[model samples]
Target: MSTKKVSIGAKPTNKPATPTADAWVENRTAADAHETMKRLTIDVPESLHRAIKSQCAMRGTKIADEVRELLLQKYGNH
Candidate 1:
């Protein structure tokens, strides 16, 4: 599938531009997730659920890693 920006009504943009001299990006560490992990709720067929679990075990990682990889791939962060 292809994606293009589309505006149904009036489109909006920033009216003011700031000086680029002060622009900077910050570095951050990954979250501490071993002791406390994130949870998700999704519906899937029984066979698909078993397949996903088996894949995770075969890859020697948790379901969460598979989920994170998937979400990052979709959302442009990894």
Candidate 2:
């Protein structure tokens, strides 16, 4: 006798896929009212990096968003 395999889990939906950067920027505007976005890179200690990632995950946040908020608070013009 032959048996068919069945999948158990939520089925995929027909919703459109959003690009990572686009989704991240959605409902968020540039601080300067400009249409350009720039990438910033910095090096951090491995332990610090892991800690930030873990905390962000637990808080349901993104590292980039958190960093941006910090930078804006420090240097952005009110």
Candidate 3:
């Protein structure tokens, strides 16, 4: 049997350092400047939701993004 000592409070050496607070805030500000976003919710059947999720995954897209594009296509001018 082999035993290794570990420190509970020690940070992992292999991981990259996290972004500074200033950098994160700057990035978030830049993103928010492009658009103000709102949330929409609708009830969906379980099977329909699963199918949509599967299709989005296969197409390398997020379900929300796909829904946004669809909405834009249908009613963007109005």
lDDT of each: 0.70, 0.83, 0.79
Question: What is the C-alpha lDDT profile of model 3 across 20-75, one tens digit per residue?
Answer: 97666455532424654555789999999999999999999999888878998999
Pairs clashing within candidate 2 = none
Q: In TM-score terms, which candidate is top?
A: 3
Clash counts per candidate, in order, are 0, 0, 0
1-78 per-residue lDDT for model 1 (tens digits): 999998698787878876463242122234653343334578999999899999989989998678888897899742
How do the residues 11-57 of candidate 2 rate in per-residue lDDT, one tens digit apiece? 98999886787567554567766655566889999999999999999
Q: Model 1, 73: alpha-carbon shift in Å?
A: 0.4
lDDT of 1: 0.70
Q: In model 1, where do residues sit more than 4 Å from their true spots? A: 1-38
Give the winner by TM-score: 2 or 3: 3
TM-score of every model? 0.48, 0.54, 0.55
lDDT score, candidate 1, position 42: 88
Which is the better candidate, 1 or 2, if ranked by lDDT? 2
Candidate 1: minimum summed lDDT over ten consecutive residues — where?
21-30
Decreasing TM-score order of the candidates = 3, 2, 1
